[model samples]
Target: MEKDLLKTPIEFLKGVGPAKADLLKTEMHIFTFGDLLTLFPFRYIDRSKFYKVSEIQSAAAEVQIKGKITSIEEVGQPRKKRLVAQFEDSSGRVELVWFKGAQWIRKSLQIGTEYVLFGKPNFFKGKYSFPHPELEKAEDFVKSPMGGLQPVYPSTEKLTNKNLNARGIAKLTKALLPQLKGVIHENLPVRLLEHYKWPSRQDALFQVHFPTSIEALELARKRLKFEEFYFIQLSLLLQKDRQTVQTKGHSFDVVGERFNTFYAEHLPFELTGAQKRVLKDIRKDTRSGHHMNRLVQGDVGSGKTVVALLSMLIAADNGYQSCMMAPTEILAQQHYNGLSELLEGTSTRIALLTGSTKTARRKEIHADLLNGQIDILVGTHALIEPVVQFRNLGLAVIDEQHRFGVAQRAKLWKKNAVPPHILIMTATPIPRTLAMSLYGDLDVSVIDELPPGRKPIKTVHRYDSNRLQVFGFMKEQIALGRQCYVVYPLIEESKSMDYKDLEDGYESICREFKRPDYNVSIVHGRMKPDDKDYEMQRFAKGETQIMVATTVIEVGVNVPNASVMVIESAERFGLSQLHQLRGRVGRGADQSFCILMTGQKLSNDARTRLETMVRTNDGFEIADVDLQLRGPGDLMGTRQSGMLDLKIADLAKDGQLLQLARREAEGALKEDPRLQKPEHAATKQFFIQKHKGKVQWSQIS
Candidate 1:
């Protein structure tokens, strides 16, 4: 066997012809022999351990037993026909049955033979039975050292249809191992292998697929998991070091009149300690004359917007233009209005650009932006349009940064000769492990404290039995001159019959407090843009006492006077969404409340989510629990697929392992930053091969 042979098409393997090869390729993406070699097992079981019929107690437990079949018989009608066999050893006797492939099994197994049987045993009516136990002659089974762990591979029905189950896969792996001996090249460096006491690449692969013992399997798994995490950390660290050396940035050497004037005259309130700390970090990056790729994370109402505004002002004072990109038009408009009010008497000119901008205003704004008349430009994805050129764009602030794609952010780099400083802000706090893996290449700054004078929102859980009581509470809050939001989970009546249920709830609310006494504004995704905006504005302006909507209002809806958030079917929503909806309230000075209303029956995960919401308003804690419940993919949504390319490692469970991997990667880089040493060549080559065709976000940023 040679290196080229390992790369040979899997169809060349024995017992796998053209038809089976095609099915393997289509179903499992196994094109080459090497691909099949790396399909590791998900679990393993003891093969040597045997049990007697008298030792069986639990029906759910699988056991291996040594016995001889005394007799065999077929029972039941045509469709329900089954083959049953009486198996007996010196200790006891057990019945074995097969519902599928009974005729084939009957033909394959012989009676009056000493065979080793392995299967799960079930007990009913004081009798124990083994269903379709694996049958092999005692002498044949004894020849193979039959006491080690057996590998169980992940398989699909399509592959199983082609007679390629877990056992079949193990057989193929057993066939391939002989060829791979002395053929697998070492991927990790010699020093790393010696220091970690890890096995060679060949030994790890073989042991992981077919282990001789439990200890060997554990060592094999550790080696592979470490390799997976090490490469990711190496790539991120390399990109980060490259950015610091290669990308030059506009230096805001002095915090002059614009920043000073806003701080002195138009400052909204005293900055919180977390806000001050993050601002200090940003100031240091801007002053260093190196491109700043930083992420600012804070919970809702943590005053992240004020921090963004202050950073933009620093860019302005340095005689450079700045822009802020948001995920939606509503959010962009909110930023524009808030910043406009903050800089009312300032000399800096701010402009807004979104999809709905008028043609005449768009032309004026474009002209001003190109010539540097507009000091700061705030907009949605429209800021990335071809015509949206800027004059010396020094800083770019992205709000709800996860909503935008890498390519969209890359477009902002073309606005100037040099890439502008990037400061990404997210209100949904990310757990530490997720943040480390996801944004490891960038500088992370967390704003952990809310601004002073903001009281924590009082959260309560309620059942459907207290529907009238909850409505009365809402009425009481509204009577006190505050607005309320009633959020439902679904929108379409046809899709979720519960949409009709929500409509009935809405009708009841209207009927209870009718006419001029209480005007309610309803908004959802189905409504037209104008209609939705109209309703939102009415509620924001205090013209409407209550706003009924869906999760579209989860982000960017800032109504300071709103004090109550009544979430219907709260169990149906995730922890992050529920937190964001609750954030809509508690923005004002008055005491705020969030009522989580759900049915009596709740799932374990759903109950944990609701309890976490009620217990604390800490976004980081919620995010950690959410990660444990839904994993990184569902928590981060669609844009995280490319970034979280973990194959063998688990982010939630392997946080400590990831930290060790990152430290190892960093130590290696510190010793040889460019990996130019002969000893580092293997590690460098391994990284390139592992990350082929993948766009590294670190490089793009």
Candidate 2:
């Protein structure tokens, strides 16, 4: 079989047998040679040089040394065994200690024999030592291919037992590289290659796997990053373009003067700068000849809904119907209720459609919508049903882009005579570079400023030791006629996390608040739809003061009365998620506070996260920090959320690169909109070849 082309079973790969193959495929989701090759390492280690015995501190770290074993001893009992070895090189001496699994090392090591050790270098009493370090004989020295720069692939505890480490990956790549044809596929234009100074595809692949120098590694990394960002930008713009062509964006002549007069005379409150800016942008898009594929992003409580309402009003005043789709039934009901109150005396028709509605009622609503009797229809995914149709759908606004699928988008488009202008909204603020790269196809408007009189939510970090204090604060808020939210992470993802802790948390709260009079509604992944709706409605109505929930409540169902949000074990959460939870509060007029309770022992990254939460309320700034702290895959559900399709780019650290790549892609699209010619052949082929994993990767184009 050709080395690069072979479809060898993972079991046949060097150093892997049936047992390890099972572990790889079952535990780590790794299968086949190609799958292993694409499994990029999560991190890398630097082993530039050997450390001096005198320089070794009490701190624990891996150290490389040339040493000979001077003495050996067994110290612990049979039940908990430990082996200790004394070593001395030409310069100084150190000790090697093994715990629990001592016999494996004892057999691997012989008295007075020299060996290489990799492990935590520690000093005890007066001598330098390594506790239970990885030991190998002197003959194994030549086998260390990763002596300097090493990539550490993500692994499970089960796989580590099989000794399938970085070298195993290198060996596999080595076997496969030569099998690749000499004149392998080239998917980048020659002009692009010259402008970006990119290496050939074969060279980049080989160098990325086993780079000979730092420069080679950097070149390989850059080529891959460019490809990643370019593909993502291309996908986004393509999707946007496709939507633009498909949707006619029926022209709406909204009488803004009346709206302006209404605002100037009876607006009642001052229009926030953000609101004005967003409204202006919306009006321009609605009136433009081309379809408006725009995304409106803002933080929670920044009045994004009002801007959306005003945009819908533009469509309504133009004598055309509009629709707003929310992810949940509760939110749809909420929007209907809000609109019914806001447009009480106006002729703009408003109706609600959800899965729970009676068949007769849904049919009537659908008929009314078709006859232009209803001006605006708000609902859950039920809005996409084939029977639901609009008479003159001029503007369509979708809240929370992630919740709706492409099938739904098509469903939405079919509702209109000339498909409505698309307006997408999100309460989450993504980094600018990422947004441009990801949503570049659509026009983007950001409401960066919060409304006046909306006080920033006071945030603080606490340890488990201050549990009583947190409970005290909760009690005070409850007594003050305010409600609280206790959010827990999903118990288990896909039977992956059945959080006994979730129910345990609810039970504990039931025990603590202790008063039978206090109503606490519990909601988690296990609950039925009605149960969840009941709990949410109860909480919304203040029938229940505190609602214990999972992150499911992060997106919709706004409560102006909830003022306190207490997140337990908050360190377990990412920065963006923490911000989202904080967003659940601060929506009401009463002063709001977010308490992030963590454990006493926190990792460095966790510390930075806690500090960021306490030090600022800026969502964009926090998004930047989140990107820096965590790469795209872990930051925003990139893998599953289907939003992030980056292959080699880091949205946080590689913003400049993303910007440059997006500029190039956008320029390329402008020159040849379809990328059908010889000039764009390479880029198009690259997208087809490389950006097809995980998500459909269609959203990028």
Candidate 3:
């Protein structure tokens, strides 16, 4: 057996020709013999236990029995047809049914022949039956010596139609296993393997697909999962090591008058302990003279913006320029306005260079930037344009950095002779396990606490039937000089549908609140930029008591007086979006409230989301639940990261395993960073071979 043989094209396999190979690749992504071997079963059926028909009492459990067919018949019309066979054992009789594949089943069945049947028993209308049961002649049944679990591979209808169902796949795997006897070799170091007490690569692979016992199955799973995650962590940590050792960065060594003045006199609120700790971490990175690649994660309204501003102030104090890039124009504008207001009396020159900026203003800002006059620049993707040059750009603060593509962010690296220190911020909370994998290269800072004097936004769930009560509560809050937001989800995902919903909601608010006493503003994504800005401005200025809008206002809307948020059809929104929408109102000093309204009928996920929102204001907890609801791939959109190309390891359930793998990888790298030692050579070669062309490790943020 040779290692190269495992890399053979799947089409050349005994049971798989070109057609079946193509189907396997298209349906299950099994392209090579290696892939076919690694396609582990999703579940298994126990072949050891056989029960008599009369002994079965509950449909809750599945059972296998040996029985003889007494009679076979086809019943009902063509639309709702079924093939029924009366099966009898020593004590009693039961009906075996098939609603599909009846023709093949009928041809295969032999009356009065003892056969083995496996399926879940169902007591329907007081009659015992087994639906779509698996059957085979007793003589043909292959018995496992240990009564082990029979693997059930995943297959699609297209493959099943071609005689490549779960059983068919298992047969192909059995055929491939003999060829892989000594071909599979150990990749990890002997010491590391012994420390973890993991099975060999060959043993793990063999046991994973065809386990002789439950313990063997679990051991195989653990070994494979560790291998997958360990390599990912090793790759990431190695990238980080390279970046830290090789990359030179500009140092903001001084916290001069600019920073001191802002903190002493101009700071609007006291920073939370978490914010201070993060700021300290940033300060250390800047002073360390290493290209600071840091990710700042915080929940909404956690004062991440203030930390970013102060970090920029430090750059400005040290005669360097700083820029903050946001994902959206609205968010950019909000940052510009907020920072400008924060630095009102200070001489820090901040410029906004969004797409909406006039040509003349843009030219002036660009010139000012190059001349080193503008201390801070804030904008959207426009900041990445070639024309937007900076004189002495030292630091970049990217808000919601995930919204930008790798190419777009990479452009900023080339803007300076030495890549500027980067501080990426995200209000969306990421689970710790996900963060370790997704953002392993960059150091992470977390601002987990909200600022002092800010009250937790009281969140509540409501049904459509309680709309009037919610509206009354809003009126009461409005009477106390606080503003309210009435948000509605789109009838469908289209902007037109969203606009229509906003319009209808606006009309209803007008009819309910009525006249000159209560003013309302409406904003949606479909509206013109100017029009949306006008409505947003009106709402921010407190000219309107209530603003009806879509999720366009989910980010960067800071109105201190807005204290109530009424979200219509909140069940349609994800947990993160709902949290962000709720964050829009709690900026004010008053006790803010968020009312989530949905129909009586809600899905289990929706119910969990709403209940989580209502139960606790902890964004991290909500994010964890969201990760469980939607796995790591969808949670952070990490499918593109290649770190999530896991076959068995689940980010949600395997956090402990991930931590262990990362720690072990970190320890291994610390011992031999380049894997130059003889024992580590195989591991290094295996990693290089596995990830050679598939991943761009440097592309990870």
Candidate 4:
């Protein structure tokens, strides 16, 4: 814990010094001893034994061979400095050669000498030569020294240039193992360690760095992986227990019959089965004695807003105030308009409050909200202002859940005597296992089905070579009097990147649709707020025939008449994001289409992404494929890995483990709520170490 406890260069750590420390820091991002301790290898290389050319397949990537040097020869110019030292083992002979670093290679290598040469033995010009391989003296090259496994740290380009590549990381690990203090002697309880047969902290660190065998490494990993899930679960359960202890609420007993009545009598549309089930779930939670912490997840245009509205109405019917906070002003306004129109015949007073509201108008709205005159208030993050108080806030529905931090979302709970029941909505669908791991404190409801009458967006993949042909299709769609959208990756390319910039794309579009009468508007991340708003307003009003922009328009924008979406370099987007962009077009009554434009040259993964877009309109199915393709962290938006975090325990590969872990965690928490007793001591210690005694991060991340 002491930052300056050790200030020695890595090379001085019994095996490293100034030069090696510089190499390690510049190459591996390792500076402090702590950094070296946590600098986990990406993989483990098996250097357990030596192999011969005859013993290895011709297609083997690499193989280490123990042999005696049969001969040595010099070839190439002085600058090239090539040297070949042929080695012969019982199975066959392989030549160890060096080209550029021959000066060191020649000093380390000799003819008629036994040595250990580690490299791929290959036939180049009718003979074998290792470009540059690891060579050790015959005496020091004890087969047991490398007879088991090798750690392969993540290396960088700088590492390669510094000649501190994979082997360098391995060397650093070997040298630092003795210096590593097992901060934990037996952090986990003895029972758990014995039950799981997990390695001790000291054993794990050593086995992971230099394992005796693959089985030991597997045991070491299991020890750490179990700790990651255990701590995460313990922290979540402790927080949940802490909150449940201080109960807040005058529980609403309404069976949500009013909503069903309103729907049956005045409903012009039908509620999907998923929506009804979700509404029932929320009603049960709200009516129960406990406060509700619920998340509603749905695909874009899956009618999540309507679900939120119904929940708010249940609160309003019970004479309690409810507020829905949208991340964007446009979405807030949309909610206001829809609710105001829906509850027109009811006594539920509703109003819209946003940052753009006049000072005079805001003052009146604030007065109304505080007096409980407004039963339903809709606004942006402006609703969180200390000045805006709700008399009896019973429900807080947040749209686009990820936009707001947990601290901000919790603000609404403090607004009233009884902390408001929370309903969070997200257009971005989450894989169920991820939703559970991340949102364990809350209940989740998913709307996997789109509403009836909404058409699936037809998708097609296009290459730049077919740009002119695509332009023809766009013109044809425009001739139908419907609007179109062309989304670009970014406003401009980065310094290193040479992709088509948005401004460049905009200019080209103008050149193609050159008629002065044609209306084309550009929107991107760099534009001023007012300018962006104006462009969006124009596009929404049908005043602009084409909206060429970035992913900024993917969320909170509603345009019904737009029938075509063209996403440039569609390979650059995540599957969820691409699906959200496509959702923009299908709102119209007319048949809509999404055209994905990717580069002519595509990798297998990129091709799979494009093909997935062309194959299905179901977001859940696409999401399942996405999880299979990109792992949970990438799909969920961040990557972190450990006992406190994780380096592996991949959610995609071990999804079943997550399920079992969740079930085990829930059962454990129910039995040992406080986690204070000796039996739960290990779980308690795990969370305490993870949060440093702060339970909040566990509740959120």
Candidate 5:
């Protein structure tokens, strides 16, 4: 009976009529009682303290006051009118003003009756007033159930216009809570609840919405957050278990000639301990006989490519072809070039395929790939097209994994009979907390250290006024036979403005550097693929002294001779993007520098981003700051699986809670892999209901 009531539409609630219910559904996505119940407050007010009219200060925040409505009148012109009431307590008098619902408020308000007014106090014309104050009869206010803390639910202007503001939503929640008394069954086992000393599920729901005190609110928040993370981790871990048990992967047990030769003869530098550890994890996964789906997270220039190439070599030794996919043509070509250089002495056959590939070349590459003659294939999205088939493809490496959608990545799985050992590579370091929640299903391996002999890039912030000095520095670097990259921001939302900026910057660079002494190549998204590649190759081959471009060079322009990166209007870029742009330099040993150029005026967030870029080169540290500034949603592109849409659990602040929840979830799954135990019945039922109709993208990763 309680479950049915919880599922009932919001219109059936006491204070929500059909119109209000429709508004709630459209504005807040509150369709049923369950949705409304889970619409937790963003903040709360302390109603236990009330100030007298005389005690209210002009600078005071939201305040509650006790007073009597001595007089009321309508003022101002039609459609611009407001109702004002002069209210007096024993000490002083203040005005209560209403602009929106004046007529209804004036009709309901009783003069000479004591009432409680709650709102932010605004001071104007040498007087203090409460605008659109929440008015309640003194007697009713005393008898009200919401006494200690007042929940402030999230609201919209449309909802506020329809009298469904935070207070209105709170009223609806208050009325609906009683109906959930017996309905909020415990999804977690009693043993777990007792072990954590947590409140009952029903009690937590009530306290979270209308807590009696701060202590109760904290406990309630913890319990709910744990439940959210626990269930998500449980679901992800379950998917991982199922994949391990059911999916069969080709065993690349023998690390034969190619891998050993590359390690002993072709490796340009010694592998860092972190890289070695990650490679070990990858090797273990590939040979476990279960489909390998692993994510390798490393800072930019952390040698993730070498690890991926070695993994591919292992697949080649196992007599299976491997393929690497990048999001852009430039990156694909760069990978192909780098891998080709590494395997120059070996007999390994590698091919590059992209939209820019000639028709004849693509046909040759396609035929070779199908006949198992191609040891490894590297390309952009073209690799996933149906025309591209692989003979016993054993390993698949994806760079910048977040740039591809789940469906796009899933296409690679269909390229072979059994899905290849999937390896996802990313230069953007993900915080451990976010990784657990975002890519929880995949086994994660991080290359935490950069390869030896790589010097940390020096970063500094400069205002636009310092442009001449920056240019001189660039010239000095160029005079030393090193190249420079001048990058302009290219935000998609304002492409025209960005394009103008890029054009203006490029022109200025050409005029300042001059043609004869300094040759500059420009690249942007609007450039033809061939033109962009030509410019990129010019920069790569040292034919161009300076490369003026947009974020197109952000991923894959490899120039060891390029040592200076000047990001124009650096404040316009994000933390991760700034780190990536800085990464473009510092690839070589010659003391690279990243100069962040910004305008004098900077917003606090923009300042933080620039400051963070100047502070450290640790990608994970920068990523954590990025998460705090831009939030989890924007940091991880919006196309992610819906798991990060957490209702109450904040990935930024609740790291410890997430860790605890993950450990508990792992323990639970270890005890009952299928969640079929009698003690786990509630958890299993809740997990199924929660995840119903959700596409499992874990398999693709």
Candidate 6:
């Protein structure tokens, strides 16, 4: 068999001509034989059991019966025409109906001929009928390759119009499989095959398309899924290995004065065990002289900022400047103010650069940054500008790193002669399985514990009927010198509707609280940036007892005095958004409360989300549930990375298999890092072909 046979254009296949091939390519992206072969079936139907006409029940599902068409006729008016045929077996008879393809079906029907029929039985007024039944001669059915478990390929309306439906695709696959007998090379090594006791790639592909039994189909799926995951893990692990050995970075070898003074004297609170463990990991990475591309994941308000600040202090102690880039200006400003206050009695210098910075201030900042006078600079995307050059940038910290693209992050690497050590942080807790698949090329550290003296936010669910009681409780809390946030959902597609809701809610709250006695601040996406910032500052300064707005303050607004979070139309938000909004109030030592408001009617998923929020404050647990509910594609915007484009394996359900694949890939690389061994020749060849002409973005975190 030739190696390029599978690469042949799909139009060259026996049954698929140019017209059908064009439809396949345009509708399903199938351009070659290899692409068609790998288009695995989403489901299968068992055709082995044949039911007698007398045994058919009204509630019966899809069934096959051996019968013959005794009579045929056309019924109903011209526009509502239907082809009806009386199909008879040993005991009784059933009607086979076709509503749309009457002319072609009626002409093809053979009277008094034994045929096999398959379809779901629909129970009408007093009889069971099969609609659009698939009819095949008994002798032909016996000789067909797809007799037992039939594969059902996905199709589009355009493809189906050209006779390229599931059955049509099955015929093409059956034709292509025979040609692939010896052409499908075994990519896994013999040792791995023997250890896992799996079938060869050729046999698995065949069995997946046309299985003899349920067990064979299961085994085939397992083999293919493992192969997919194993190759992905192998690619990511190889990237990490190359980056570690080839990339050089600055070595911070000393525990210098700035770090010591901050840790010993000015530390606000004792570091948690998890934070300490992560710091130790960072310390090891920086001292190894290899560029550090590490991700630090912690829940909201889990003290990640403290870890970032300490790491930057280490860079300053080594006579190198560090910069922290945020996704939004509000977050950048918050980080700048927090870090400056934390370093207040020390000699370390810090500055902020954002889009709103004055021209004079910008020039001063740029000059100071070039002269190495600014020890640490923090800002939004402005930090990545061409003018913001660092004299000797030893480290770069990114907050909410997922919000930035790979190209934007790569720009930071070009700032210095050698790329600075990268520390990426995210409050959106990614499930471990997703993290392994998405960020496997980078080292990961998780701060799983919250700081001391912080209490878990109490969460509850309430319908609109309880609005008065909720408002009364809010007034009581306000009288105690505490602040509150009343947030409404802001969906992009329904912006006007959401804005109206916000406005109405704000007016009613103002009427209930009565302005002079209780001041309320409003902020939303439509407001000017300056106005939004002013409202937020008013609330932050304790001038407003209640802040009514949208989810604009979801990420970076920090007011420790705000102890209550009231989310309206709570069912409209995702679990992560709800969790982030709840995090806004728990920053202070006082007991924070999150009240979810919804209507009487709720979806099952919405109920589950509300219950989960009330049951636990664990971000990881919530993230796991979110992954199961939303899948890996929508979580954390990972779809943009193109890494999660999996064909068969599911990140939500394949965690154990993913772990096994990671372990196997790691072991294989450790034994033969370059894959020069004879046993790994197939794997190496496949990797090269898969990654050919692809840009390597593993150097950027």
Query: What's the lDDT for all of these models?
Result: 0.87, 0.76, 0.88, 0.75, 0.89, 0.91
Clashes of 1: 1
Q: Which candidate leads in lDDT?
A: 6
Per-candidate clash tally:
1, 14, 0, 8, 0, 0
Could you tell which candidate, 3 or 5, scores higher by TM-score?
Answer: 3
> Tens-digit lDDT track for model 5 on 15-69?
8889998999999999999899999999999999988877877647988888889
TM-score of each: 0.93, 0.82, 0.96, 0.85, 0.94, 0.93
Question: Per-residue lDDT for 1-701 in model 4, tens only?
Answer: 32242334455565556776787777666676656766776687677666776776653567777778877778887777688877788877766777766666577667777777777656676666676777776678674454567777788777666666777667766776665563434556566678778888678867877788889998987776665565666655555555544465557777455565667665557889999899889888888778788889888878788888788878876777888999888688878887777776765678898989999999999898878788888999999999998888888888886777767877887898778888889887777766666776677888877788888889999999899988889889888898889998742446223234777888888988876656898886667878988999899898888998888888756889999999998988878888889988898678999999988888888888889999998887788778888876676543122212455566656666666666667777677665556866755655555566444544322
Ranking by TM-score: 3, 5, 6, 1, 4, 2
For TM-score, the strongest prediction is 3
What is the C-alpha lDDT profile of model 6 across 1-701, one tens digit per residue? 43588789999999899999999999999999999898999999999889898888755688889989999999999999999999999889999999998998888889988999999998888888988988999999999877789999999999889888999999999999888888888888889889888889898999999998899898888888989889889888877876666789899988799999999999989999999999999999998999999999999999999999999999888888999999999899999999999999999999999999999999999999999889999999999989888899999999988899888999999999989999999999889999999889999999999898899999999999999999998988898899999999999999999999999999999999995898999999999999998999999999989999999999779999999999999999999999999999889899999999999999999999999999999999999999999988788774336666677888999899899999999999888877888999888877776776773533321
Clashing pairs in 6: none
Find the 10 residues in a row with the least total lDDT in model 4.
Answer: 637-646
Candidate 6 lDDT score relative to the true structure: 0.91
Q: Write down the worst ten-residue block by lDDT for model 1.
A: 692-701
- Once fitted onto the true fold, the runs of candidate 1 whose alpha carbons sit more than 4 angstroms away are 1-3, 70-88, 92-97, 106-109, 122-137, 143-147, 491-502, 638-643, 692-701
Worst 10 residues of 3 by lDDT: 692-701
* Tens-place lDDT digits, model 2, residues 625-671: 88788765564443235556444567778888888878887788788
> Which whole-number lDDT from 0 to 100 does residue 240 have in model 5?
74
**What's the true lDDT of residue 217 in model 5?**
90
Candidate 1 lDDT, tens digit per residue, 33-147?
A: 8888878888887986888878888999788888899999999999999999999998899999999988888898888888988888889789998776777899888886434
Residue-level lDDT for 613 in candidate 4: 90
